[model samples]
Target: MTAVTTRPGLAPRLTALTKIVELGPGRLDQKLLSEASTLLTRAGDRLKLSSEHTVVALAGGTGSGKSSLFNAISGLELSPTGVRRPTTARTHACVWGLEGAAPLLDWLQIQWRHRFARASALDKGESQLHGLILLDLPDHDSIRALTDTEADRLIGLADLVVWVLDPQKYADASTHRRYVAELAGHEAVTVFALNQADRLSPEELAELVIDLNDLLRREGVEHPSVVPTSAVSGRGVDSLKSVISSAVSRRRAAIHKIEADLRRLEQRLSQTMPVGQALSAPATVDEARRLGLTDALCDAVGVPAVGEAMENVYAERSSRWVGWPYPRWLAKFRPDPLKSLRLDDVSDEIRGITTGSVSAQAAEVSNAVQALADGLTAGMHPVWRTAVHRAARSRSSQLPKALTEDLTEVAPELDRVPGWWRLLKIWQYFLVGAFVGGVAWLAVGLTVPGQLPAALQLLGDSAALPWVGLMMASVLGLGALSGIASRNFVVLGASRERERLEREMRRRVAAVSENMVVEPVERELGRHHAFYSAMRGLSG
Candidate 1:
């Protein structure tokens, strides 16, 4: 993968991987993650089994002399070498140290009959190779599928691999492509042995070595190790031994293998999860989308309709209390704005009450919510955008009842009487009383022609007719004029109430939108940002 002078430790990378997998549930490729998890678990189990013993497998395709190399290294013919179609079918393991190696061998699935222990080989100049477990694996390019499969499995478990190649098979593009190139990032634990070198002249041997090195360098190795070895002549065997000894001495082959494997996996994840825009803080839903959602909710719940209703209901109430006393009772005949929309009562005060009120059309609400999701996740990956879309609409089922409850809490009081209306009513009542008294006195004089009260005797003499009639006309006209003048005040108050109600409705609708849409979408974006951040740690 990535080159850094000093990288973050294994624990952090492992932690980062776990974070990525956890946060990537619906928005990442699960198959890729599953393989990473399996590799981690398997690597852990292998590391726990043995670290002192380095398990190095000799792997090569058909007729590559892998068995001969194994025998030459172990100083014994532990593996059978043959030629028809498939040779070295079963794996043969030779362990230099038997102490703590049985468990590792068992885990590798090596049969006891095919395993060897060199516990007494200290006197054969093999002390330097003390902690090594060399394995001769089956031919990977065998005609028999079973042998090929066995070789592939064992080679994957090996900490270090020595691939044998002869003159004929050194340039086999298909073989290297299928095996060596696939392990591109694992150059630290790999070596290619150019075996059977006795067949070529000195000049030809040098040319073959140059050609083999060139081939391997093309497969992602800056400087490939191609040791020329002849099993019969024992040439270049010491060089191969030196490579194995260095790995065993460090006792870090197993750790290196896991590290390389992790890099490969992280690279795979990087391909799918684009390194997002540099995020300096936790993600949030933008203000434009938030406001848009609130506006939509206001429309959906008919805030404008409610505002109009408020003004009508307020004006009607005002007229009932302050109108001319003669028509005061007739105000009740008008329709109440709040009651017409079925919004006066609290929606959930009683159980199982459904709202019959009109709201903005369903399509408008749906489109608004969709727009919010689209704007919030504008440049996100398709999978993450899908998650944001789902989050935006997650609570859509509760929108209707929520809007109804909010409207109920903010609905204006229809029965409330203004403080000044009562004063106006009393003035009108006094004028009406004066008109009634004047009418009664005149009527008494008319019916009983001369039987007038002493105080009203002048009005009965027919000379008081003009003054008495003027007095009654003045009281009636004053009451009517007062009622007509109050109309302007009533209209002004109603308009103010309508504006107040609209403001309150918009505020409550914004709260509903924040709860149902904006918050959920932000949470999904937060998850994406967290995942992206962790992946950056892996690169470092």
Candidate 2:
């Protein structure tokens, strides 16, 4: 068969495949990508589009008359032919040109002893087959390991393969299943020749051709061109030569071969990727699950203890402002709640104060993360599932440290005393002063005699002993009332402060979850999207 027309976008398709292979570092399957890279390199090195040479290999099973066909097509006795089971032990190359096909033959690794060149003046009609490197490969079923290896190697690299088959062994199961069926997508560069046609009657030859066509169809080759040729009689040699001439003139054998190889690679790599659109993570974290994670991290960061300490600190400061003066002085001796906990220090560095509940909290956070990852990868393929799981756990080792740091950074303003507290403190001080002054006045009246001077008598009459008692009683009553009213206000303020600390702690924990887990998984999903888009371009 002649080579098909050159594909319009072959260069772009190959470039796309190259790009996909380039993205193989940590994202794609290592082994498969490595194989694809090697295939691409080989295709690039072996098949040069401007080389002006087309390598065609004649391959067949034992007793298929492949060597006879090779000689008949080349019009020379270049390949040894006999009635042996496996005639060719090694590959033989017959090049039509003098100098240009040397590099191509060297790539084929054909020994100089086995290489032949056609005479320039033999026949003008044969000039149409110039720049053709015809090769006779060893039998596919050869017992010799070296011969079979050579044949397999050449078949893989050949731009065009002409499968030679004897009429008797044309329908052999091993040949059809192992060889022909494997080249299903390579039909554009493949030709089938039924050799030794002289052995059969004309009617028998026609029937054999029909049977071979049916077998080829079953092998996934649609509309195969099977030529009936007798190498001994040179019956259909011209038709086979015409096919070769057409392929050489078009100079698209290399492109077609490379294109077919790329197609096969795409098929293999597709199995590793998901089928339709790419998968994406949930837009927002699950609220119930997020709350659970926050609670866990709060426990890990000592938020409950911190909140309680915050409330105690608020009440302690309030007492200093509203309590009785004598007891308020002693209140300074009591330790501040936040200072006792060592959380009052303003430092950017994370403290190493180990909490007994952190390990359990860490486990809870890990479980929530695992559940989230599982939900995200629920309907994805196994490959993508593994990727998602890896992404979710990418920062697991740093979760504890990250949560601690964030919680400490977002710690609430526990040291800020409200403005009302200062005003209440001034009122308490004034009431205490008034009580002291009243007591002093009464003590002076009891110790000293009645005033005899005119001015002193008038002042003493105005500030009588009963008047001092009434003033002292009034100061005590107001002070008690003020303390009673402020107690409820202080308690309410402490409760509000505790709630504010809780909110701050929860916000910090939520940020940790997003950074450590959610973002990494989403980035991986983005890579999957890019891979799917690249694969779609391969089909086009």
Candidate 3:
């Protein structure tokens, strides 16, 4: 198993694991297991098999004498000892094949074997050497570098690894940096041996092992095991075998590997959790509504009638989003926007609130909507353009239709006035003009000799006038008066009619505006609320 120990608390670990599983099939969680897990599983399997086989795969750079060391341990030269870059291609497993442990070997799938039943071959064949399965892997630094890859793969699966080094090149930086440093976590399952030890004296061999151990310690191996041996003279080979036997008997190395692997898995699982504890639940509908979403919706529609309804709803549900704790007197201004909702008044007051004050709030809202549409069209897709065009056409059609329909509906109301009132107003102007004209005509008749003043004519013949002049004066005066009166009446009637038509048009336009524009806007605001809520949920 990996070197690190798991932190206390099974609940958190299990929670982490559950989250890892929840990540679905794409996650590679097994790689997250610690080396400890790997060691534990290997140990458990070995115990159940009733076998003490500790497979030690010897792996290192080319000419590291890995195969030679394998031959020294097995005592029969099972592997070719060479100075070539790549020593082997296929993996070579040397099993002890112990009695009553056949099932264990079968489990290990090591069918290829070398038997040494007699005492003579026992020394020759390396069989029953405390039930250790030693494998000689290819060189890691070979021209075919993938050979090293296979060696590493086998090392992960092995119970133990005897990393064979040389006296001259034992301190090779490449070997230590690339392989030894990485195996620091598996110190229990790994051992470093200085091969070709015949080149040095006993004291030198001891010094070298001490130095190597110190180096391993610095590389994170707290207590590294190091041995000195020579495949040429067979020095210290028996000691190496003994160490392997002791590890096999206890199975510490295998268990440690499993524990490490499991630890790695645990860490990976932990990453998938909520970092420390669980997060609070997602935002609720009540919370969003409290944020003036409904009010915003009403404003988006810019309808006064709907704005009233939405405000009521907002106040009713405000308690859910914001807690209510005050008494009635204190609660008088409890639902204030700045104090509770923290919303902008300008945005909320898109619909006019006053009874009779003229408000261009609807126009303002429309302007805001148009701005938003323009922005969306530029940034998003051309579909917004189509949608905007379609809406404009629809609104254009609806407005005129609503205006004409409302004017028709309210026509009877305007027509309900008494006919006598209209006639009286007409007669008042016409009769005044007619009376003035008649007076002027009689005056003109009197100005001439015989046109008028009949009382004067009876008084004296000297005051008498010509009959022809009276006739001419009387006819011209009557015609001129008739023309002037008719012109004045026509002008007054036309002006009054124009004023009446304008007032009626204003009333009809207001009704149509309420029904056609404001009503649909409010309905659309409701739809906007639903749409935004669904989108928010989907995003979360």
Candidate 4:
């Protein structure tokens, strides 16, 4: 912390960070503004507590001499230093006296310990480094996962990090892959310390230091300060102390930590803000004005003037349900006279909206309703109905999907009607032909005198009349059979048309409902709605 003025543009950096957090990237800025507000609040808290002492954590892997260096920096063997794989289990917090820093310590859940580094215990030279909270964290590669977790937790809260490394493991693949690589851009608040330099000769130590510095530089550390030290010989302890004091004096590490927090907050804010394409509301009933479905339905049912015709038809039909039939003039005066007639003709309007053949439109609407209900439910719990309106708003697209699904749903149900009806109608003609033939046979059998006179009554009181009656009976039976056949055919045609119309109407309705209603609502609620609402109950 050499008190060198802050690398100009601190304000701009703060502004950019605020923008990023408040409104993520451009496309989703509006969506993330609220989240940005939350992050900004946290940043403000951190800034408001500027009087707090900065926390600089010492982080490293097993056998990295972090404990040894921690002792050297604090000028006391506070941490157990040995050849074991892991030395520190719990964290050791070394606090320097500074006013109004208690809140920060409490936030970190750290137990305070006085700094007692002597001014004479120097390799290069010892210096008093005040206004800093130094932490010696547990080994990142400790055998216990808990130790690693502890180190990571402290690192998140620390304002600066001093990464301690042994020459041999400095370039360890795991170290670089997991740790150094992630903190590349965070070099401002990070420093590299090559510990155990006593292991190498002076020349070798100097060379190793140069190589280490070069390695850090490649990892985005511009002019990184790499110090060589040995707890056994007190090699570079003084220089390390001086460096720590300088950083503390200038609060470089503190600023860097705040910047990092800003970056993180900004990233989070982006999520809350709107960016890119503007959100679109779902299509409404009015939007399909150009579809002309209503007109189409009116035309199909042969009632082009549907609006007025519907009123009259309804009134006419309603007139039938009432046992006390009203006079036509009187019925006209009744409220909703159309209801009295039961001649509501809005089916055509329904047909038009469905946008298909009369039959097709009916089917579409039926299918749409079924699908919308199914989709609105599906996996949803019973209690989920409470959030339904919100859910609809969020998943606007779902409305359309449901509608389309229903359009196809009723087609199969209506198809279940038997196909034999048509054959019956054809059978009626054959029966009529048989009756004519029978009559001719009977006339010949009787050998009635000179072709029975026109319309003359024969066999009146005659014994042969009984045989004629039998013949007539047989003819009548044949006619009855023909009648049944005809009825079947006629009924079958009507039935088929009825089913077709139903299906068409249902499908059209579904399409309209989905496009006009469901899609927009779902889109709006999808993002913020809790996917697993507890109110959904045990079923959920």
Candidate 5:
């Protein structure tokens, strides 16, 4: 337990604990939160600021004068007190003043109760102790487990605990280990009373108090106020009452207990949170692993095969635009690459892709993602590591369809005809018309035996036929040059398109990884940080 000077009221502490639960959720320990929640509710319900009653219990081991001290303080024989070992078997409560304390006593589960009225003439300055409900609980180290359990439960519920110790058992191991040692942060609500001090000599009593103080300091109860009291002789009992009276007047025992409870929870939760640093996502995705995953996806999506088919399509289309007119027509017999693969549709439906390769790619991607998740969550808590892994593989089932959709959308861009290709197609058609016309003129001039007809002679004489052949040769040569240029141009464009498609595929893969893996991991890390901050606030 941690000690702090400033005690937070119950409401603020409860609110902070609630925020921790809300912010952390699955990332924090469930059992810890459950226990904290139970304590928070108990504190809220038990501590009523408007109600002037203060519940204090005297908890001690057998032969510790707990019942005797209780009877002396209340000035009534409500609790059984004798030399018999473990005299009190049950809890008994005595409420001061005329005010009603039934609800508070009922909350403490104390059925046997006594009411003590303040005598105005005798208790003139003691009006401050009006609403004190002092209880004498059973011996904490009772022979029966049930009696001990009852005492333990009531001690936990009490806003302030008066630990009554006999001179003989003041340093008992069981008493200190089970009760005093555990109430480290609750030192403000704890009062140590050295009962039966009349038996010891004054010097011995002084020495015993000094020794008890040293023992308590070693037990982690810092600077504890130990009062020497005698239940039989009524020595130091008023001092004990004054301590209780001051706490009651201040009405801060409940707040102190609640703060102590928060401190206890803070100490426990701090162990679970990583120390010295906050959790965050990795700066960037692992490039090599991402590329490896993309390559596997490309194989499944048939990218290499599609790229080859694209080159072939460009070759065939370029031939039609600028190849020798005779063979250019032969290229039309080949099917379009994208159309043959049913990739040209660009519709929402995924078609013509094999499931086996896609499934294999999904498995490969899963493995790569798992590796990335493991690396990211290395040295993390098991709960957070499990969360990161789950986030990494969250959308694995839908990946194949998403990849296929993205590939189909980008596939149609490969078959896009450039403006240059269209312009060259028109030039090739004009050249073909000229070549055919020149051939027709030459054929007629050679086959004609008699004088040529006037219309044909006007077109060109037989001597002009050489010029026609030269003109036709020039057209054919230029057409061949154009075809060569077009092939290179189309091939270069196809290469660039292949690179672009690969880049697009990689981008899509990165998107999937970001959404499915990176984002989820970061969210969990953010929760971890927030939970840590909340714990810090509560602890402080």
Candidate 6:
């Protein structure tokens, strides 16, 4: 190959390709990614080797005369042509200069016998086509499997492709659908040769060229080139050679091929995913949404219900402790609200087990979680939106267990009883005892009225009986007043305890929300951010 320099600005593009392959799988279609995967693997090997020799392939279907064109271009019968043979079963290479081409040819997997070097050009001083390696590929529509296989393999690796078509098969279905359409946006390194044009009249040739270009346009080529040619008469042969020579001299066709491949991959990727779509998504949950989620989860985990149960428990226990003696036994028959729901006296463990009775409706939890995912991923690309939503749902099945465990840990905080209740209990018992004892003494005094009245009169003269009666009534009234105050205080304490329980329970449920939903959503957004950043580097 010639000592020409390759194009600049290619290393960065390759780096961009590396970024895409590394970050694509989780966010890209694997089938589409397979194209990038093959291209990237091929590009790396190709870039490591020589860039001076621009490999161009002449590819077409059977009876297209591409083999004839290949022989005409080489000025030698390198590829045998016949009606029975139909197509080239294997690839044949013709190189203008042989230097630095062995490694490239080896990489192409071309056999040694099929290789040809033009030594006559050196003797004749025809150096115009120097450093060019033209490949005669097998027919795309050949009945033999090896022909199609070799054609496909060579077509993908070639730096530039020269499609050799004839008047009859220029718009063939197999050629357009399988090959031409696949190379849609790669128009830069593509050339179309309308071979066997001598068989058509001048008007027909011009019209065929127009029809062929129109067909190429429909296949996604922007400015399709249809060079009319005749291998028998050498029509457009020099023009095809000139096109090959121009690419060889500039030495950018290899780099341009990679660039075109990258563009095509990027275009297909964008069709499925809008570029920079992740940039607009919300990365952090707002305070309002956080509160909303916490509230929802709190309900699902039965935080508010537990808190209300806490108050009922606190009040019920208070009745046995501070209630007046006459009615304190009634509290024993009442069921503790907290115990009935299996939240009574939770163990002081981080992973306390609670019953399913505490859970809210399942649909309620699902809606809340979905809402949270939707809020965070607004305006995100479908790829990342799906990822974020999936992340949010990744541990959703564990939510009921997580919430119950967290609620259990927080449940023990409500069981603490105030110390004042104990002191009040002693005071209430003393009053009940005093009141009962005084009534019993009065009844016994009535049985011995004469002695009791004489003893009372001796202690306090004529007013002693009425004064003793008034003293007994005063003691009864004081006990009643004390009982009323105890009831009021118990209610106040229980209410305060309920409020405290709610706050603590909300905190635990919030922790559940973070693990089950918020954290996953954030992690997904992080992936999207990285993916988009890599895409930006690629676009540059």
TM-score, every prediction: 0.79, 0.77, 0.45, 0.48, 0.79, 0.75
**Model 3 worst lDDT run, 10 consecutive residues:** 274-283
Q: Which regions of candidate 6 are displaced past 4 Å?
A: 1-30, 84-88, 119-128, 197-204, 274-279, 283-287, 319-363, 374-390, 412-416, 423-496, 524-540
lDDT, candidate 6, 54-109, per-residue tens = 89999988899989999998888999886545444578999888989999999999
Better of 3 and 4 by TM-score: 4
lDDT by residue (tens digit), candidate 1, 1-540: 111111348667767777887786766778987876777676767757867788999988778888888999998988888775333358899999898888889988999999999877798888889889999988888778888888888887888989899898888876777887767778788888999998889999999999888877787666677789988788989899999999998887887877777787888887887776424433887777677888877777767766776676667567766777765546457676447755444222211112435444566677888988877777777787788889988987777667777677767666678778989888888988889987987787677856566536665565677788998898878887888777678988889888888888888888888888778888888887888878886665
* Predicted candidate 4 versus true structure: per-residue lDDT over 232-339, tens digit per residue: 789988787777777777766666765665554444433333221212311222334323433333233333233334333332332232212223336557676444
Q: Against the true structure, what is every candidate's RMSD?
A: 6.3, 6.0, 21.0, 18.1, 5.9, 6.0
lDDT of 3 by residue, 348-426 (tens): 4422222222232445434543443343233322332444334423463445444444444322121133353355435
In every candidate, how many clashes are there? 1, 0, 40, 94, 0, 0
RMSD of 3: 21.0
lDDT of each: 0.78, 0.75, 0.52, 0.55, 0.72, 0.78
Segments in model 4 whose C-alpha atoms lie over 4 Å from true places: 1-50, 85-88, 112-128, 217-225, 261-540
The positional error of residue 356 in candidate 6, measured at the CA in angstroms, is: 7.2
User: What lDDT score goes with residue 152 in model 6?
Assistant: 91
Instruction: Score candidate 4 by lDDT.
Output: 0.55
Candidate 4: residue 439 Cα off by (Å): 57
Report the alpha-carbon TM-score of model 3 versus the true structure.
0.45
Clashes of 1: 1
Instruction: Give the runs in model 5 whose Cα sits over 4 Å from its true position.
Output: 1-13, 22-31, 47-51, 83-89, 97-100, 112-124, 279-363, 374-379, 394-430, 451-456, 460-467, 481-511
1-540 per-residue lDDT for model 2 (tens digits): 222344677666667677778655676789988877877786777645335778899999888899999988887788888755444467999888756666677778999888998866247677778778899998877888789889888988888999999988898887887778777678779899999999999999999999999989988888787888989899998999898888877777878887877777788777776455343434334567567656766676667777776676667667767776766666568776546755445211112233322222567557767877787676666677788789889998888778765665555555577898889888888988988876776566556676324433545575464665777898988887788778778998889878987787778777887788878877776665556556666655
